[model samples]
Structures are given as structure tokens and as C-alpha cells.
Target: MTHSDTDTLRAIQHTERERFIASHPRSMALARDAQQHYLFGVPLHWMRDWPSPATLFVAQAQGATLTCADGVGYADFCLGDTGAMFGHSPPALAHAIGEQAARGLTCMLPATNAAVVGGLLSKTFGLPMWQMALSASDANRFVLRWARAITARPQLLVFDGCYHGAVDDTLVDMDPLTGGTLPRASVLGQVHNHAAFTRVVPFNDLPALETALKQGDVACLLAEPALTNFGLVPPDTGFWEQARALCREHGALFVCDETHTVSTALGGYARAHRLDPDFMVVGKAVAGGLPCAVYGFTHDMAERMVQAKNAAPEGHSGIGTTLAGNALTLAVLQASLEHLHTAANYAKMLDLASVLEQGLRDRIAASGRPWTVTRLGARMELQFMSHTPRNAQDVRDHAQSELEAFTHLFMLNRGVLLTPFHSMMLVSPATTLNDVAQLLAVFDELLAALRALPARPATAPASRSA
Candidate 1:
């Protein structure tokens, strides 16, 4: 890039920094070179969340912090979007990985830890059988396929604005007119018509769910106990009982994706709340920041699911990955189950999250701002609106982008970090009280600054009231 172009980019970035500044020269310089090789300027497109010029290229992460290229250290509340929710490179997880590297990696064979982990899962989730996958998305896909086969049903049901990690069956959206899935306009290049195979209903609406289920073609109801991606919309009281009852009446399997909400308790929100889903998926931090994800089924369901699959023409089912259930991963899972993710760890995390959420909520109220913080397990989010949202659309309608960017940058600039996405924050056992206080202090400052800003302009395209 020419000096003039570089200077122009810098000028635009200067304007952005005037608007958002989590960067300090070094991050910008690094971003310039990175854009030449990597797409969207940073290694990952989503890393753009750090600040105006670019994301602070991370040098290393230890415990609950980020060491950036600019030599600034930040308290990392993002925690790799819960991928490192147990705290980055935890000792037990690391030791297990190193030990397992020597013990041999992948084989179609099961490690002795497999049975132990299975029992642990059964104890934690109240589900008797467990299956491993490389990611929560993959596990969800396999679960849906199993559901389809066992029930011999063609239609799948997911909540509106629910995210199940890129599985095709779960991608179908609500048709604006028919109010049913319609090869979702956003769905692209799919060989199979997902609309024909999927249905979406407003969450927490038992009548809506029952109406759809009445068709009798629904295979499974895939959902997060709490919606995270579409902003953390928790279900209304007793919503689960009503929804589960509807599914039972409809003969649809209930698959709860506790990938994010599992941080709620050792068994996940489902077990904690006594909601008995046919299958439960807990991922992201299950193996203590390693690449492991799992799904569990009740004993009867597991037997039937396996039989249904075996009764099919055999080949790779496109379900399991080569490195999934590898020795290193299993060892990590074993160590994680034994040393981390314990009852004590969960209690600590949930308590810290409660503190953080209360602090933010108090600060928001003190600022006289229209915002509220909500918590589910160890995950808590501060939605930028006065009134709480009831559903995804309500949350989306009230989202405040400028306010979110401002708050995120404000936190980064002050040495506290939060998730890049506007939706959430994660708390791990390793997160300290001082660290939580730091975040609250930063948030207090951001809300104060936002209060100083002039009235929202009619031209402001982004919603900041989320």
C-alpha cells in the first residue's frame, strides 16, 4: 500500500478511533500487514470487534487475560466465545494434552477414560449414553439425523432466531408470509431444500409450537434452553414444561443445545431445571478449552438411535470426524471432568457471574439508562434497553450498535474486555473478584460517557437501545 493510501486509511481510522479506540498504533500496524494475507484484515472476520482500526492482535492469553500486540493486557471476558471458558490453557487441561500427545492421538478405539467420562456425563446430565464429536455443531447435526431416522419424520423444528451452529437442517427461517420455513432467503446454495425439512416457531409460545407439531411430520425440536446468539432471551416461567409437553404430544424429540448454557451447572440448565430433554448437548468448554463436544441420550433413546442408524446402508455417516474422540482430546476431557468443571468450579463461576450481572445492572440503573443485564448460568449479558425483551425480534428491534461498540471499546481501552459480540459475557472459575470489579468499573464509566452524548439522531441507522 502507498504512503498516501496508508495515510488515508489512517485518517479514516483516526475518525474511527475518535469514535472507537481499543487500539494503540501497534494493533493498527499489525492489522495492515495482516490484511494483505488474511481476509477482512484480521485472521478471523469476527476479530474486527476489538476496535475502530482493527482488532488488537493477541500475543498470548493466560488465565483470564489477553496480551495484545500493543503490549497492553486486557481482562478477557470473551474467553474465546466460551471456547476457553474454563480459563485459557488451564494447568490440568494442558497437562492432560501433553501426556496424551505421547500416548497416541487418534484411533477408532475408545480410551479407558471413555467409560469414565460417560458415567460422569450420565451423572451430570441424567442422560445415560454419550457420543463425542469435534464441535457442538457437529453433535447437533448427528442428533438431528438420528432423530430423523428413529422417528422417520421429515420435518425438524427450531425456535425463531435460535442458532445451532451451521447445521443445514437448522438453518431454515420463518417465511414472512406463510410464517413457515421457505428455503430461507438467507440460506444459500443448499442442495437439499431446508425449508421443506425445517420449521420455526416463536419461542416460549406453547400454542405456536403445538400448532406446528400438529402436522405430525416434525422429527425433533432443536433449541437452546436460553437463546444466546439472537441475544440472550430466556424462556418464560414454566415455558419448558409446556413446550416439552407439546413435543411429547407431537412425538417430536427434544434436543437441548446447552453448548453455551452448560456453564449454568455441572449438568447444564436442562438438568438443573429438571427439564428432561431426550438428548442434551454440552460443548465449547466441556473438555476444558480443548476441541471436544458431546451429546447424550437416555438409555432407551440411545439404543433405538443406534439401531436406526445401523439399519441403514453403511458408509461414513458424515457424522464423526477423524480426530474426534482422539486420545489427546479424551485425555483432556478426562482431566477436565476430574479437575475442572467440578461442582465447586460451577458454583464459583455462577456466583461470579451473578456479581458481575448485578454490578452492571446497578450501574446501568444509576446511569439512568434504558438497559438491563440478564444471566443464565455463568453467562450474563447486558441488553441495551430499558424494558426487557420477550423474544428474539423484540431484542433485535431494540439492539443498539453504536452503544454496543462504544461500551466494548470503553471496556477494552480500560484494560477490561468483553465478548466482541454484543450479546454476552462468560465467567469461569478462574475469573477473580477483582477482575469482575474491573469490568463493572469500566462499564460504569461507559454508561456515564453514553449519558453525556447528545440525543439519538433521527438518522442513526443502528439500534442502540438493545
Candidate 2:
């Protein structure tokens, strides 16, 4: 881009940042005080990652709207990054949680709802057995141990740019230039070398995947149905079928993480697409925004898990935590699955997302910019590239950090919110057509402003390091 173009973008970003601060005085005050208590001026470090000049303080959130501390309401397309995907405080889940809390919270012992939840999970994900965890990260970690025990292998294979939570092993990324696995720079306090045991390959590349699996030392191929982290990268045709077949052929378990893709359907992407995964994980919205996750496996995999446990030394087994499968979590998870996570609700979400997808496409077209939108079920992302990215490297090669930041800040200032970390937006059962239209209208204005910038020759792409 030219100097004039850079100046225009910076001027727009500055104006938006000032507008946000001027409107959210209460939020800025709270953040100023919070800085003394919280390390990053927020409870969680990721909360600081939003595009706002200061961390926006939430007063309350219900359905698809969130009111900030300054009393400004926003159409919350982010939805707590999928933890609130079913919508905040759904009546059934809230009631279940309140009742369960009155009785007890955590007891290390199984609750009466355990058997019912297990059966529901089996039917939902087409798996025979289930286990619980506090989060998707825990489920992924435990499943990795089980996979290693079952396959007697030490290495775990994951596609590039895939995120399976904060699992130390899964945090490794494939170096774009060298095509070698390395620990992601974003991961902090790392004591172990994850690349030593975590094999990385590009998604949608069957030749690379086959070569990695043929090594005969992989315990499991952990992946999402699509690459969702660095914007959306939907799988190519017949990708899962061939990948699952290769996993079976190489004596490795195909572990599908549906924490994000559960929005694909009530049955999750694995069952929705008819892909046979040896193990499946569903988290985030599984318990209606509660801190809970579940992992399930096929009957054969269950038997292998039992055998592996029995054959091991009588000890911790390094699988589950004491607070896992607590009474409160089981009750809420059961309530969410039976009441909120239903086909009817998903149909509504899908319809709204379709509307959003087309609106984004129309807006992008009007701008005459080389951009594309990708969708997987109710989730969609707008990428500043000419076409959909096939892998993480492709995403990095076309990433537009400054453009993303300006767009995010502009939208947030206009009482709309997209996922701050990316250009992704999700439609929940509670998200209305009006809310989506509002977002698109704001985006249309922003695109028009961006389109006024002077065009220039292309330069080398920059990664989103921050």
C-alpha cells in the first residue's frame, strides 16, 4: 500500500478508537481500576486481546446482545468465543444450574444424570462411551493420553493452524518456511519441546498427511472438521473420509475436536458429515456456557481404553481431574443437550447464518475488493483474500492485521461485535435477522470507507504476530 493509503487507514482507526473511548466512559473507568488488580487489566489475558482501546466491561449479557458497563448494547456475534453459542442464560440450562447448585456443586462422585448424559452423547455423536472434563483443553489432553496408551505410540499428529485448546502437545505449529513442527510463539511458560512428539502437517493436503501417518508412530490425528482458528478453512471434498481411512490404515486414532464445529448441527460435524472418528470431543457450549466438556469414543475404542487402564500401574493414570464430571456440570450438560442443543434451534441458527453469509458477500462485492467469505454451518468468516485459504500458511500469506483491527474497532464502536481475534462471526439460536442486518449495514459503511483508499502494488504478506 502507498503512504497515502497507510495514512487513511491510520486516521480511520484513530477516529474509531476515540469514538469508542468517548462512548464507554464507565468501561474505561472500570478498566483503569482493574489494572491495579489484574495483570493485564482483565481477568483473563485473552480479554485484553479485543480491539477496543480499553477492555470493555460487561454489565450483563442475555440472548444475542451484551450491554457494556457504559450502557451501550452490542449485538454479540462473538458469543464468548463459542462458550455462549446457545445464547447466554438459556432458561433450561440456567434452571438446571440453579437447582444443581442448591443441592451441590462438585463431589468427585458420579451424579444420577451421568448415565442419561452418556447415552445422549452416544446418540448425538455416534459414539458408544463418554467422559467429562472441565474444558476442551482437558478433554483433548486426556484423550491424547488414552490414544497413546491404546496405540502404544509416542507421537501426536495435528494439522497446521489447528487449535485444540491449550494442550501443550497441540500448541505446536508447523513452521511455514521449513515445514517442521515447532512450539507456537504465543504459548507461554513452556517447559517441554512439543514439536518432539507433535507431528504437524498442512490441512487439505492428503499427500503430506499420508506421509506423516505412514511413520507408524502416531497415536492420533487430532483435528477439527475444518480449520477454524486462523479464519475459516473448510475441508476439501472427501477430506475426512480419506483422512479417517489413512488413520485406520496406519494404526492411529482419528480424534475429531468439535468444540467449535458443534455449531454444524446438534449431532456435531462428525455425525453430521458421517465421518467415523475413533474419538470425538465436544465442549464450550456443551454445558450452556458452563465450564464443562465431554469426550466420547466408539465401542472398540472404549474397550481398548478399558484394557489400557487395566494394564497400567495402579495410580492416577494421568487422565481425569478430581472435579471432572461433577454434579453441577452433568446436570447443566444434560439440560443443554435435551433442551437447547436441538435440531429445531440449529435450523434457526443456520438460516440466520445463511442470511449473514450472503449479506457479507454482497457488501464485499459492492466494495470491489478482492475478499471472500467462508462458512461452515452457522459460523462464517470474512477474509481479506481473493479466495478461501486451503491451510494456515495460506492464511498467513494473506493476513491483513491492520485491516482486521480497523474493521473490528469500527464495528465495536458502532454497537456491533465480531470475534476480536479474527473476522469470524457466529449465529446463535437467539440471534435475530435484525441483529445480523445491523452488523452487515455497519460493515457496508466500513467497506466503503476502506474502498476510498488509494490502490497500490502488492507487497509481501505479514503474519498476525500480536
Candidate 3:
């Protein structure tokens, strides 16, 4: 990419943004009306982050498509950013939630379905004990408490560019220049320094990980099977094997956060790869897009946690919320585990994802663009670089924000929705080959527009001053 090419892309994005506002009068009006009551004119502040001129108000969503307030249907590859990864409003989940709604929503007491769900979870995830929370953020937070309690250590080890929900400790990133941990600058309203107890290491770097653990201070190593937040960066071959060994050798608990990587398999990537971890978490889709997150533990880990709990003076464990593990959530989880997360459904999702991956690669090749595509089961991401990124710096160095904005807006105008934060696309079991083909066709148009830009002498990107 050149300066001229970037200017041309920005111009195209401006035109697309205008086209969106002109076409979506209903959504624009709704947004204007909502501004009086809602922050940033939307229920969630992040909704305003989309490249569209205004937030799109979804009238309805089902399967792999959603209708906006303007009555335009879009092939919804975003899938609520993997919260609806299985599919929107799955029939079994809908029925279960409806029935549970009449019975009662949330009671402090356990429901009958809780036992059944426990059995299914143990069978699927290879963990003997489980706990619940309202979101992956809560689950990760609660588990970190348990980790510190059991290991009696003060620090946590996390990879650079990793995202484990909004947990405060995991928000720290490695400062590239000084190689020191720093709280991510994007996080809002932080008053305390998080780097004191959080050790940051780059993904796939075994030596750095070993050196960090050798300090004998980390209580746990919290990680995802693959990096999906900044972009999809898969683990190198045999990476987890050595990483797990190092954690165990250093007496630190190993935890895998599968909130996004749950799309990889019925039991998530940890079970699929036989990577033994003391704790594992699955959220978002676990309760059919409802607010529920489950963290599981191995038998030994469970025993250690029990001992920690027994030793504490009884007040509050600082673990659960009032709405955690409600009857409605358990009912939905039972239905989803039984029907939605089945092997057959996953096969369909994986097949569709393969089609999507190949289609994007073909389009990139045809356009003569130095772009690449990476897939993890049902999830895939398109990076504006020639190869998969190896670490966080690789991701930053290769990112083309202007190009991403233009591509996202282009797809939005053509009744397709990619994830707002990145060029990530997810394929559900309900996604058809025709839908994939349609997305590829629009992608071809985007490429053609990029190729039409006049060539110019390329200038090197300026070096960072700080």
C-alpha cells in the first residue's frame, strides 16, 4: 500500500458511509431518537464503533441473517461477535428458555437441570467440577482469585495481545520498546497500575514464558488456545505441550479461556487437542447467547480449590453473582449442549468455514493483493498482510486500519456483516454455500475498486518517535 492508495481507500470509505446513511433512514432516525436516552445513541457504547454513519438497529436476527430497522437483510458473519456463534435463536434453546421463563427466571437455589448440565459438561470438557458466572469476564476474574488462593502466588502470566474478557489483570500488554508490562492504553478509567502483578509474554515464545515462570511468583498462566482478539493467530505446532509442561514444572496453574475458541470443537480446543489445563472456560454461546459463563476444573484442581474455600473465614467467597447459574440459564445450557453443540452441527459449521476461507483466499489471489486468511474451525480472519502474524508486534506492524474500514463499509453496503473490530468472519451451521458465494462476489467488487486506484511512488511508513 502507498499513500495515494490509502487516500483513495479513505475517499471510498467516505462515499460508502454516506451511502449507508442515505439508505438507512429508519436506523438513522432511530439513532437520533435514541441519543436522548442512550449513550452514544445506542444501548451499548461499542455499537457506535461500526463504520456506518449511524448504529444499525437490528429488527430481527435468526440463523445466519439479520434484518435491520430499514428492512434490509444481511448475511450476518459477525454472529454477535461469537455470542450467537451456534446460530441466532436456535429452536431448542428458544423452547427451553420459553418454558423456563414461566417456571421462574433466577432463584438462588439450584434447578433440577443443573445436575444434568453438570454431567454433560464433565463428559464434554473433561473437567470434574464447574462454576458459573454472568460473562467470560466474570468467569476469568473468579478463576484468577481461585488460582491465587491455591498457588499462594501474587502474579499472573498472560501472553501479549491476549484478551480474556475485561478482567483487570489480563488487560496489561507488553511495551514493545522497553519490554515491560504496561496496562493497555485503550482501557478506560484505570486508577491503579496493573503491571505489578501481571507478567506479559509474547505468544509462541517459549523461552520468555519459561523465564517468566522461573521467577516463582505467577499463580496462573491464563491463555487462549489461539489468539483471536487482535486477530486470529494460531498456536505453533507443539506450543501448548511445552507451555503446559513449563507451567506445571513451575507450580503455576494453567488456564485456557475458550470463550472465542469454543468454535473450534464440541468440547473446545483444549479437549480437541488433549491439552491438559487446570481450568477451562466457555462463555457467550454456552447458554444460547444468554448471559452465562462456565469455568471448569480438573479433579485435582477442584480438590485444591475446595481446600482453599474450607480454610477461608466464611463471609463471601468473592466468586459468584446473584444471577449466576439461574434456572433459565441451566435450562438453555442443557438444550444447547444437547442439540446445538453436537458433533453433526460442528461438522456443518467447519465445512462452511472451509468454503469461506477458500473463497477469501481465491479473491485475494485474484486481486494480486498481499493479504492472507487464517481459519480456526468455524472462525476465520482476513489480515492485510502476506502471512499469518507470529506475535503482537507483527499484528501491529501489518495492520492497515484505513483498508479495514473501507472493506467493512463496502461489505455492509452489500448486505454482508463482518465483525466490526476486525476482518473476522464466522460461519454457522445455517450458513449456506449460496451465502458464501454471495459474500465472495461482493468481496470481488471491493478488490476491483482497490485495483482501480491510480498507482503512485510508495513511501516508507514513518518511524515511531516514542
Candidate 4:
């Protein structure tokens, strides 16, 4: 972008910020009160990442809508960043939570419904053995430990710009200049070097993945079926097929982290596409917004896990937490599996998402903007570049920080909430055609507003950490 483009973006952002502040007096007041006790005026640091000047305090959230403390309602495309992918507080999950709460919460012992839930998980995910965790971060960490223990290997491999939650091993980035792993610069208080045991490679790069796996030291290749953190970069055609083969050929486990890509299909992208990973992790919306995650593995992998455990000294195996697999979470998980994770819900989500994807593509073309929309089942991303990115490097090369921030704030000001980290949107089963139409109308307004600005020739975007 040129100086004129930058000035115009900043000017629009200023107006949007002013509008937001004026309309959110209640939120502003709450934020002021919260700053006295809560760090960054929020419960979690990430809650402060939104472009709004003050944290938007929620009054209520249900279905696909969120109402802020200022009585402003929004079409919630963010959906708690996939934690509410099945829509906020589905009745089945809510009732299950209430019923389970009255019975028991956690007892550090298996719930009576544990065996039934296990059967549901195995039948749904096509994996015979399973484990539970409070979050996908914990699940990924435990999977890594198991993979390393069973294989007796020291290194793990992951794709560039992949996010498997807050797992330390998956946090390293692939250095573009050196083609080696480097500790992510933005991570705080990192004493240990994650790159020492984690090999990083670009997504959709078969040769790089093969070469890395051929090293024989890698225990597992942890990956999302499609890259979601940096942007929606889907794997190239036949990428997973060949990638899984290479892992098997090199004697490494292929672990698919479907936390985000769970939106891809009812059973997730791996099962829908027949990737058949050695292990799989699904979280976020798994229990209809409850704090639960489950990882599954093949029977062979289960046997290896047992053998590894039996061979080790019997103390703590460094896996799981006390709160995992609690009775409440299990009840909700069962309810979600029975009701939310169904063909009917997915059909509605996918149909509406197709309409949304086409609407975005049509608007972008009519506006003649150099933007592209990529879709995976019910999720879509409107990238600034003309082509869909294949890797994190591509995402970095086309990064438009100012434009992205402006888009998010502009939409938020218009009663639409997008994912704060990127130009991503998710279609939930609760989303309606009117909601999608409202979003498109606002998006059209955004396009027109940008079109009114001074035009400039595009330039290479400055590299920035995500």
C-alpha cells in the first residue's frame, strides 16, 4: 500500500473506533472496572485482541447471535473461535450440563456413561481407542508424549503456520531464510528451545515433508488437515494421501489435529477424506462449547501405547489432568455427539456456508478487489491476495495488517463480528440465510467504502509475526 492508502485506512479506522466507543459506553465502563482486578481488563489476554478500543462485554450469547452490554446485537460469525461451532449453548448440551451438574461434576473416576461415550467416539471417528483432555492443547501435548514414548524417537514434525492449540512443541516456526525451526518470537517467557526437537516444514510441500520424515528421528508428524491459524490454507490435492504414506514409509506416526477442521465434516476432515491418520485430536466444539477434548488412535497404536506404559517405571506418565473426563463434560459430550454432530446439522451448516462463500466471491469480483475466498466445509476465509495461499510463507507475503484490522473493526461497528486474528468466518447450524445476507450487505458497504479511497499500486507486504 502507498502512503495515501495507509492514510485512508487509518482515517477509516479512526472513525470506526469513535463509532464503537460512542455506542459501547456500558462496555467501556465495565472495562474500566475490570482493569482494577483483571489483567488487560479481561479474563484472558486473548480477549483483548479484538480491534475495539474497549473489550466488548457480552450480555448474552445464543444460537448465532451475541448481545453486548450496550444492548447491541451482532451476527456472531466468530462463534467463540470454534468453541461454539455447533452454535452457543445448544439445548441438548445445556440440559445435559444441568442434569450432570446435579449428579456430580468430577470425581477422578470414570463416569457411568464412559463406555457409551467411548463407543460413540470410536464409531464416529473410526478409531478404536481414545483419551480425554480439558483442551486440544492438552490433548496434543499428550499425543506427542505418547508418540515419542511408543516410537522411542526424539523429534516431532509439524507444518508451518499450524496451530494445535497451546502445545509447546507445535509453537515453533519455520525460518524462511534458514529452512530450520525457530522459536516463535511472540511467545512469552520461553526458556526451553522447542526447535531442538521439533522440525518445521511448509504446508502442502511434499518434498520438504518427505525429507524431514526420512531423518528417522521424528516420532510423529502433527498437523491440522488444513492450516487454519495463519489463514485458511487447505492442503493441495492428494497432499494428505501422500503425506500419510511418507510418514508410514519413514516409520513415523501421522497425527491429525482437527480442532478447527472439525468444521469440515461430521467426522472431521480426516475421516471425510479418508486420510486415516494414526492418531486424531478433536476439540473446541466437540462437547457443544464445553471444556473437553478427545484424542483417538488405531488399535495398533493403542497396543504400542500399552507396551510403552508397561515398560516404563510406574510413576506419573506426564499425561492428563485432574479435571479431564469429568462427569459434566462427558454428559455434554454424549449429548453433543448424539444431537449436534449429526448429518442434519452439518447439511445446514454446509449449505449456508456455500452461499456465504459465493456471496463473498461475487462481491469481491464486482468490486474488482484483488481478494480471494477459500472454503473448507462450513468455514471460509477472505484473503487479501488474488490466489489462495498454499503455505504460511504465502500468507506472510500477502499480509495486510492495516486492512485486516480495519475490516474487522468496520464489520464490528456494523453489528457483525469476525474472527479477530484473520478474515475468517464460520457458518453454524443455527445460522440463517438472513444472517448471511446481513453480513454480505455489510461487506458490500465495506467494499464501497474502500473503493471511495485513493487508489494505489499494490506493493510487497511487510513481514510480520502472526
Candidate that scores best on TM-score: 4
Pull out the clashing pairs in model 3: none
Candidate 1 structure quality by residue, lDDT tens digits, 1-466 = 2345335434543554654343477777887898899888866566775545466778889888888887888888889889898899999888888888888888889887888878877876788888999899899998888888899998889988777886888876666467777554555588887776788888787888999999999989999998887778888999998899989988999999999888778878898998899998878888877878999998889788778878889887767788888878888988887888788988899898988888887776666666778888889888776665677667766766655665676677788777876657899888999999888877776655544353232122353221
Off by over 4 Å in 1: 1-23, 49-51, 182-192, 454-466
lDDT score, candidate 1, position 453: 51
- TM per candidate: 0.91, 0.98, 0.97, 0.98
What lDDT score goes with residue 454 in model 2?
47
Clashing pairs in model 2, backbone N/Cα/C closer than 3 A: none
Per-residue lDDT of model 4, residues 1-466, tens digit only: 8777789889989999999999999999999999999989899989988888999999999999999999999999999999999999999988998899999999999999999999999888888999999999999999999999999999999998888878888888999998899998888888888888999999999999999999899999999999999899999998988999999999999999999999999899999999999999999999988999999999999999999999999799999999999999999999999999999999999999999999999998887788899999999998988899999999888888888889999999999999998988999999989999999999999998898664333466654434
Question: Please, what are the lDDT tens digits per residue for candidate 3 over residues 234-273?
Answer: 9999999999999989999999999999999888999999
Question: How many residue pairs clash in each candidate at the backbone level?
Answer: 8, 0, 0, 0
Tens digits of per-residue lDDT for model 2, 383-440: 8888899998888888777888898999998889898889889999999988998998
Looking at model 2, report the run of 10 residues with the lowest lDDT sum. 454-463
**TM-score, model 3 to reference:** 0.97
Query: RMSD for each model, in Å, please?
Result: 4.9, 1.4, 2.4, 1.2
lDDT of 4: 0.92
- lDDT at 60, model 4: 96
**In model 1, how large is the Cα lDDT of residue 213?**
94
TM-score of 1: 0.91
